[model samples]
Target: MTIRLIRGAAVAAAMVSGVAACSAPSGGSGGGESAYSVVIGVASEPDTLSPLLGYGKDGNSKIFDGLLARDADLKLRPALAKALPEVGDDGLTYTYTLRDGVEFSDGRPLTASDVVFTYETVLDEKTNNTARSELDAIKAVRADGDDKVAFTLKYPYAPFAGRTVLPIVPEHVAGDQDPNTGSFNTKPIGTGPYVLSAWSRGEKLTFKANPRYWGGAPKVKTVTMAIIEDDDVRATRLRSGDLDGAILPPNLAATYKNDSDESDSGKKTYVAKSYDFRAVTLPTENEVTGDRAIRQALDVAVDRQAMADKILDGAGRPAYGPLPIDDPWFTKDTERGQDLDKAKQILDRAGWKTGVDGVRAKDGQRATFVLRYPSGDKVREDHALAYASDAKKAGIDVKAESATWEVIEPRMKDDAVLAGGGSTGDPDFGLYTLLNSSLAGDGFNNMGRYDNPAVDKALDTGRRNQDEATRRAAYDMVQRELVKDPGYTFLTHIDHVYVLADRWRGLTTQLEPHEHGFASGPGWNIEDWQPKQ
Candidate 1:
């Protein structure tokens, strides 16, 4: 199998319970000479602040420092470590030297022991980190003297360097508590540019700049992330001056693009290319979806190009594979275009003939399946409807249903789901997790029980080999194989959009991962923002 990349410039276009006396607008600092603060509206609240559990974007909590961190250009740079880790002994070992005189927000010196504790804690069975698989390549982690840490891998994994970009918590604060039920998960202390000042559960969180931070205190003295679950409400707040900025959908963000009210406000709109892509996971165990012919037919039947233009409002691109088309590792040959005639032909060849009801039937089974999506998410709901409409053209019956995650989880093994997740770090991060058979029952990584031995081998080759040529060849094979018998119908890779006020300057965006708004998008380097004098 071979993969090909398609380079084309195409242009186009959350939840809450009541009962509490809604908390008053938190007015900590009113506008004045000392008011170097901004209120940011976010759609969802953080499940936890623990980095090990994948709390923040790219394993960054704004209060914690990782060994390596990416700059605005998505280039890996040293953060807690003084420099990039040294890979030695055939790429099996990684040695990192910690920065000198770094101190946690609690005034404790950071050492290699803290780094060891962070990794070892993640490896512990009792920790229950959702992203533990990211660190599974590491066989052992140890501290060398005071300022150095080392990692020994079971195999020579090429993406091991990027995986080391996880946060390193202070051993003195989080080492003794249960990771699942620790106070540190809520009130964390670290060496990042800010400190967690206050947390009003289910409402908002506050952060104050760390004056003693090694990277220098953030220019914006304070940040308040207000939890506003409704998309319209978030945009409304941004317009009402309640928020300095907020992550908005393309449709809503466009409203402020040329508004007269924002002309003199120094308001700016940012549209960032995101690595996140959404897909409909077709479970292989189900009789209807189990057939490779049915999967391929459905893949080509759905019009991803239309989804990007109509559903995304010109803020995304049609996704062919897991990697975004613009990504360096993306394969051009893997590009797939919608062809309804071909889809029908494939189904007919597979003995799926249209019955009197206009639905395809093969042997004793009907080409009918239930597709579920989270009820409140408008984008997913629209996508599900569009998919069902397209699948109908190929004589397939798709029932798009709205259900909560609780209901969707139990039925993932049997029903199809509209799912989305990916990152800007490495191809292995998304590929290995989504297709690996070992992760099928993990309840998160591999939602659909898609097991292909050939794909597993290709993914293994891509991860274990350090040579670029070998890795690219392996990934290319993996993409082609998936297109031939896909477990998912790739849809659109979204472009994260945000609107910002003119009061603060220097806010630059990077290619964001799946999680948006926090620690990403225009706020990727918010700590470096300066007041526009």
Candidate 2:
């Protein structure tokens, strides 16, 4: 089931329980000084905090602080490491020196040994880490002194710098455990501004400010994330004053703006921001959608503009192909647009004909296939509905369904799914992981079962070239190939939307490619955030 619908169930339950029954935690607000408590809603709970195993954005940003952090303009800035890496003339080895005096919440000192342990553990096949593919090009990692860490790569990967965003775990804590199976996943120790105080699975996670943090104490001492799946319910809770903030769906955002004046609390509005694109994946191995003609027909059938307007409510722009228009590698000459006439022509050429009921039929097959999305993901659900509607015009029978990742993951080889992928800082960090054939079935990405020799070649060339012009050309070729084969139907990139309490101030939003929780959102600069007097 999609996450949106799973959340819808919670919303229904909350409505029955009475929205007014929800109440804020007791006590006087922290008087604009000292400390304060804030509540935010997440669509789902994170799987783990261990960097070796953590793939989702929520945990990645919380328990781990990267060597480099992206600024408001998306430029690289130092976090744990003092500066960008110093590369060898050969371009095959890169070295970084850690900043002195940084300490993990557990009181352990951050050292080059910890960085070595973190990277080595992630690369170990025994770890079964989803991020292994990201480090596949790396040949060796070792610590020279207490502060210097060096990496030798099998190839000169241009994107290696951005991949350094993964958090460094303490060697003292993780050294003894087998990287494959460790209990530390549940309880992680890191140098981030916040420390996990308590976590009750499927309910809530509580975080407290880390006074010993190298970055200094966060102004908001207590941060609570409640697992609420429904969009409507989250919005309702925001309105009822049960939460300090929540991420509202695009369709419901307007409702909040329009109805704010009607409520007794007066009007509550939020600053909206956008990032990341959504797409639908058609596993090339699936019998129903495996045909190139069928995939091309579906792409042509989709009315990208109409979906953006009606479903996204002017919050999104039409996707041209696999890459977003804003991406530097995106080709302006790529072919992506709706054409019903061309769609019909392609299906007819493929020997699929309209049946008595108007659905396409080929070789006793009813052109039918299951289109699945996470039960609680409203954004994906809306996309699935839009695609299904458009497919009908091309005489295709697309049956949309909702299923959990537990169910959909195992069936990915045989079914088409509505899915989205994002990253921490750069386009390569996301694109390479999703399209690289070596990453298929790895975990963090490669969900589409898509493998193309051309894409792999381009990724390799792009990563090794180093020169800006050559690297851009390689990535441009990759995008062009994707536009032709189109393993996934591209959709619009969405802005990050948040609704927060009036008193909360100094929240900074990033155009993060993936949703990585507080660290990537307003909480990134929590130490500098202050309450209104």
Candidate 3:
């Protein structure tokens, strides 16, 4: 039986486009030529600076440098470690050796003890990290010597290596401190390429290049991130040449692409590669969506292709289930197609008959549901509107509305939600966080209150399997089950769009998830970036 109980139901509900001019900084040295600084516009201010807390992408990427980082192709590469981990014969034990001479920004040498401290702290119940579930399989983490760290897991997890993407904290500072209740969460110390300089809450965050960075000093001396909630405002700032770069909304990308400003030498635009998926979550306990037939009907009613074309403006690819088609583990044989007739038939069989107003009704109750999305998010708004229109054909009433995250969180238990989340590589990374029943309240990304024994079993098998063939089969079963149940109406996978200054060179884009960061952008290879003469 599926455990449909909504964990932390009250908090479930809580949770951007356009490129404009690259505006010049307000009080900085004129645009003529000094040290290159990039001002980026983020949707929300980071919740905390500590990587252990797992809040915003900006804070996590700055304060913590992971042992491994994903590249543009979604391939894992060593960031702090010397190379990929070596797995033992049983695949439950892995070993990694740190690169020599790596040091924290504080000038202390990085040792295996730091890695052990970071992983153990996160796994310790005291940390309360949302990412704790990601480390559930790890039985032990310890230092082999000064530079080598070894992991012994309770099971062979295929995505265990991917979890290495998390940033490592210093053992000396975090020792004996409860990570869950520590003051260091606000002001963290990291070994990344940049160190936090100033944080003016609700306004901006400033960081300077870490001079002692083991990778080498970044050519870009400073990075400033501003929390710009308004898409138009972000676009305006970008086009005005006040900011070096900003992520563009799909609707505004066309406008920027069409702009024929021959006089401006600073005209620069970049379409970064991404694999983010967007979808609508159907609460399993909700009366209107409790039935599998009703959920499947809603899925069939959605015109995913149309939404990809009109709502996403061709910036997204149609998706039928949780796993993207590009993913190697995706189950291609599964069937997903537009069949309005079939959808209407299913709703009718489920006792949802069309009423006087053409909306479905059962037991004198209208089959109406509220679809909540974050206010001021253009992409979500567009997708919600499209879903509403498509559901109308099946006699289901979908009310699309905007609300602050504070208000939306409490209603997720009883209401449907327009939500989106995905990752770059390893199907386990995306599937386990979103589908595993254990992760509902953990915040690693289970937005929908969905649970199925088959899915759970498949996920468990996939994570524990050491062989590639077994892992692939397990993930394939998960995709098939997810598609059949239709817990979330999978819409499309969107491409990452960015507008950067012409002077900045060596911007490395990645096939990232919804969250954008320096780890996947120009900052990915900041050391290699040089001013274009």
Candidate 4:
């Protein structure tokens, strides 16, 4: 599931939300204006605010509240629901009791009907949510009176409860308009602590505290996210006093390290370890990338260590596969260290002969291809360039180019893309759509059009099973299969860095996922953010 709109190179964990700007603390959150107002800079923004379209599907969406929300540890807790859902022993049913007296921002009573509507709409075939596949296990959702909701699953999906973080939408407000083009997409009302004040497309999104929020009014009266796409621009704005905080690349964030002492400056640096990974999509449709030997050679050709150090400024760890090496689910046996010699040998054995120019040629076909990264994203650009350099060492020529998603999307079938997407919860959250043969070439799910049936079977096993041993084994099989035939060259799992005004109290970092900006950032609990009184 590409940034959904950002597939944002942000966190797939926080995909449905984000947009930002930059400024210094100025002894006040918003330049000595309002002590509580804060401005943030994010690299991406949500495709739509509507949950039915997949926005806030992973929670942390400030404008909306889910039945459950994640704690700092990424554990699920009650949000709109009174407590955790009651699961039937069969694992095929989940029952949730709606919190009494809860109300949407519009003052409409929160009812079980609303929860039913939200899930049912997303499951509707007419719905355009790319994340629809994630909820495929659900057989039906019914409102048990006005206070309870029950979901019947087709199978016992292990991470289904975590999926309840999908923000509940107000049926009274959104049910009438077309689900895809509804005005609620822009002007949404929810039970969260904030209300969307305005959305200036491609510029910024402004939010104000919801005074009538069920969780109580937020202390931070106003929060504005300036949608600055370029890393350098975001850093420049943060330095110039246009933003209070911004998610910056490692290089940009390093400049602010000595802005003042650790506890002496008006601003502070925050680092969040994440599952977000930067990888090169090897389109099976391309002549150069389609070759199995070429894919295998390039996999080990790119030095993940060098990328972690030089390109990431040591802010990320080299990724051997989709899951971070440190993650519990990652298979230690699947790790592939860089072997430039082995890469060349593999290519040579496959008849990719080095020509006079040192570039590989097979049957008159040159080992040359274009690699596209989203424009304005410095991290991806640097990764693309570094990958090309590494490929060149193996007698492969990679031409790195920059373009917007509009230009890059259509060309994904033939061109390699520096793609960014990751998840924090279940392996199926990220890997399923990424490698499934069925989703090949479906929007940004499988951009390289990778089709591996063995991997697909493994993915299905991992996604459908409820047993921990069974699921773990399935994922292990998936990672192991990638070791032999990787569809994409995964590079690093980044630790997102942010610079924020030190004036706010109770601000902390959580383990983040691929979708970012707002959902996974320190401001994720903006409702709980208190002024430094």
Best candidate per lDDT, number? 4
Q: What is the Cα-based lDDT of residue 499 in candidate 3?
A: 65
Give candidate 3's whole-model lDDT: 0.72
Per-residue CA lDDT of model 3 for 333-431, tens digit only, reads 864678899999998887889998999888987888899987767888898998998899889899999887677767877777777677656777677
List runs of model 2 lying over 4 Å from the truth: 1-35, 55-60, 257-275
- lDDT tens digits by residue: candidate 1, 308-404: 9999998999998788998888888788788999999999998999999999998889999999986656777889999999999999999999886
lDDT of 4 by residue, 1-533 (tens): 12352246432222123433223333544334455888888886766888888777788888888999999999999999999999996899999998889988888999999999999998898988877888999999999899999999998899999989999999999999998998988888988899999877667778999998988898888888777787887788787667888899999898776355553236788999998999999999899999999999999998999999998999999999889988899999877788999999999999999999999999999999999988888888899999999999999999999887778777989999888778888888889988898888877787788888889998988878889999999999999888889899999989999888776678888888887776557887888887766
Q: Is candidate 1 or candidate 2 better by TM-score?
A: 1
| CA-lDDT, candidates in order | 0.78, 0.70, 0.72, 0.84
Model 2 TM-score relative to the real fold: 0.90
Error of 2 at 499 (Å): 0.7
Which of the two candidates, 2 or 3, achieves a greater TM-score against the reference? Answer: 3
Q: What stretches of model 1 exceed 4 Å from their correct place?
A: 1-14, 17-35, 258-266
